[model samples]
Target: MTQKITIDGKDYAVGKLSEEARNQVVNLRVCDQEIAHLKQRLAIAQTARAAYASGLRKALASAEVVEH
Candidate 1:
């Protein structure tokens, strides 16, 4: 079974992909890529948070030692 699909304003003839190709596109690769991308973003956010907390702690310690 073959079907025609339009993509980017161009007509493309797409035949029914094999079972493996269909599974890879629909099940495996898309979700895996999304999960990997999210994990990367989470690591960056956690690092920024740790840096901010460290800066805040240093400022607080300095303030406590200042005698007025």
Candidate 2:
């Protein structure tokens, strides 16, 4: 079975693509992978930030009680 890629609503066989076109496809795939990775990293960082904020709020509340 031939690998097909769609571009601008048109489908082309990967095996028929020119060398430069094939290289561009590879670059696009790499870029897509990196973008997905960065998005996952961003989600993890956001979750950590929220946890840290919650911890800080709890710590401050405890400190207030200790001082009182």
Candidate 3:
């Protein structure tokens, strides 16, 4: 069976790839979803990191100093 794939606004024919190649394509699609999820997780982590840094800075500024 033949399948058409659209890439860059152009249609290309992709058919009868080897079994290994087809498996690789399927694996790549799964990896793509994982990458997307990781990106979202990274964004949340960054936000948390920024908030922690801000709180740390405020805490440092508000700390009591002891003079000798």
Candidate 4:
């Protein structure tokens, strides 16, 4: 089966992709999606770590030193 694609008032023809091309295209799309998810997770972790560090610093500063 073939397909017709139109772009900017121009008509283009695309035929069925070969097996290798189909596999690679699908793999690339999956990899891109995985990368996007990982980046989002990394950002969330970094934000949480920063907030934790800031809280720790504040707690340490407010601690009273007891000389016994």
TM per candidate: 0.57, 0.87, 0.67, 0.68
Candidate 3 local lDDT, 13-33, one digit each (tens): 566566776677678789989
For candidate 2, write residues 1-68 as lDDT tens digits: 99999999999999999999999999999999999999999999999999999999988887846453
Pick out the ten consecutive residues of candidate 3 with the lowest summed lDDT: 10-19
Worst 10 residues of 1 by lDDT: 12-21
Candidate 1: residue pairs that collide: none
Task: Provide the overall lDDT of each model, using Cα atoms, as 2-decimal numbers.
Answer: 0.76, 0.97, 0.82, 0.78
The backbone clash count of each candidate, in order, is 0, 0, 0, 0
User: Which of candidates 1 and 2 reaches a greater lDDT?
Assistant: 2
Clashing pairs in 3: none
Per-residue alpha-carbon lDDT of candidate 4 for residues 27-67, written as tens digits (9 for 90 to 100): 87799899999999999999999999999999989998678
C-alpha lDDT of residue 65 in model 3: 75
**Highest TM-score scorer:** 2
Could you give candidate 1's per-residue lDDT for residues 1-68 as a string of tens digits?
56655546975455655666555555655798899999999999999999999999988987857578
